[model samples]
Target: MRTDPTQPRLRPARRGRFAPSPTGDLHPGSLLAAFGSWLLARHDGAEWWVRVEDLDPPREQPGAIERQLRTLEAFGLVSDGPILRQSSRDTAYREALDRLLGSGAAFECWCSRSDLAATGGLHHACVSGPQAGRAPAVRLRIPCGESVAFDDAIQGRVAQDVGTEVGDVVLRRADGFWAYQLAVVVDDAAQAITDVVRGADLLDSTPRQILLQRALGLPTPSYAHLPLIVDAQGRKLSKSTDAVPIDDANPLPALRFAWRALGQDPAALESCTDLAGTLAAAREAFSPACIPSESVALHNTGVAIAS
Candidate 1:
């Protein structure tokens, strides 16, 4: 099967996702993430998927997942694929953990938070020996001087030495729950996600995910971390009481606000009156170059501070 040199190679279609935890309602900050991700996907003529990160049941609110999805729908940010819920994907995570453990890239960790407190909350070795009745957490064994580096589509070149800066990160908790680091890596690879566009708060976690992808022999997706939307006090919208939930009944204001927060010109959406029209205009006017690399603050009225 000889190939012709004149033919251009075909790149895999871009697949992007917006995975949200069901900890709370769809707030302005989250809307910014969803809108940014959806806009980028649409602008690239790619598929956009939604995933519910319902792994932490204790932290998740009842019916929050449904409400969040509904809000996205109301804002015309619909998923192109069937929704994926992390709660139903434990088997996949377990298999990924098993592979890492078998390859010696991961190990059973018996150290508690208190046990590693002296090491500034980083786990290098088990401080507390195995307890008789305690369950052990699983962690990746970050090799000495191991460094992960990648060119973020938006944030530019980013690098991190997991061994020094992060140390060993947990895969499965002692409480018998799968850690987010493992589940997210597995899910993204499973979904063949080519580009990850999310909030800048997750920028630091990108290297860890890339490390996991290497350990599992999976392809690392391109990353584009959008600036996070914080409250007036400079707290991330998710963690702040000032975070306002998007009112799906009247999506225009929030839609326009999110559009502006993405560094896109709000004038692109000013002519729109409905969700579909606003999204379409936004997609047409979206410029990856316009997106800010720094987090922006939002007032309770959905206004950007010097934005």
Candidate 2:
């Protein structure tokens, strides 16, 4: 199996994307990610796109995508291009899996969650199995000693040993849906995204995506992981934590707050009439270095001023 070298490489053009799964409403944490990605694309003079990761049908809320889009619109984070739906990209994902298999970069494993759990999470037993051709989830073969390292604009240098840390990650799940890591790498490469800006919660996942890019012979994109928004309990804000959804009825205040949370000085731009202008101002003055590395609690003011 040979790796395809014809896949596009990252060039000077500014292309970025914000992909969100339709599992729930856009909470404050979600807004921070959207704003961060939007600002990164704007600052780099790049085109921004959105991809609906509705691949996992069971977990998707019937109207969650529409609600999420409205929330983003309310916050003035409009993306270019018709939104790409991962559910419609089954053939593309299958082709990518086939390519991985042909290149000997991926293999089929029949290990179930319970089976893998018995051996302490890592799929060591599956890797040593003698069975072949079982209807199994496909896993990428992480080459030994191969290191995935990338320079993150916010987090600085990041390096991961794929074989030991990530093990053989799933490409196609036994449940029939494609894994997030595989779909993301494929979509970003297809869209020619050169930069990825999102929340710090995904910091660990970056290495896995980098591994996929290497195996698929695709160009890796630049990354900037912003500080994560957390609740009073120190857990990352999400629907489960009852984090307030973006207040669509009055979005300006929340947008202002999100900018400040990302370390942009929003005080001077208080007079900005609309969300778009506020975001524009933020991009003009956006500095990744300004964002504090630590997570701060949001106050009644919606701002994440240092604690």
Which candidate comes out best when scored by lDDT? 1
Candidate 2 lDDT, tens digit per residue, 136-202? 7888887656567888888888888766766778889876779988999999898888888877888
lDDT of 1: 0.88
Off by over 4 Å in 1: 300-307
- Candidate 2: list runs displaced more than 4 Å: 1-11, 125-134, 300-307
Worst 10 residues of 2 by lDDT: 298-307
Ten residues in sequence with the least summed lDDT for candidate 1: 298-307
Error of 1 at 225 (Å): 0.5
Separately for all candidates shown, the number of backbone clashes (residues 3 or more apart, or on different chains) is: 0, 1
List RMSD in Å for every model shown: 2.3, 5.6
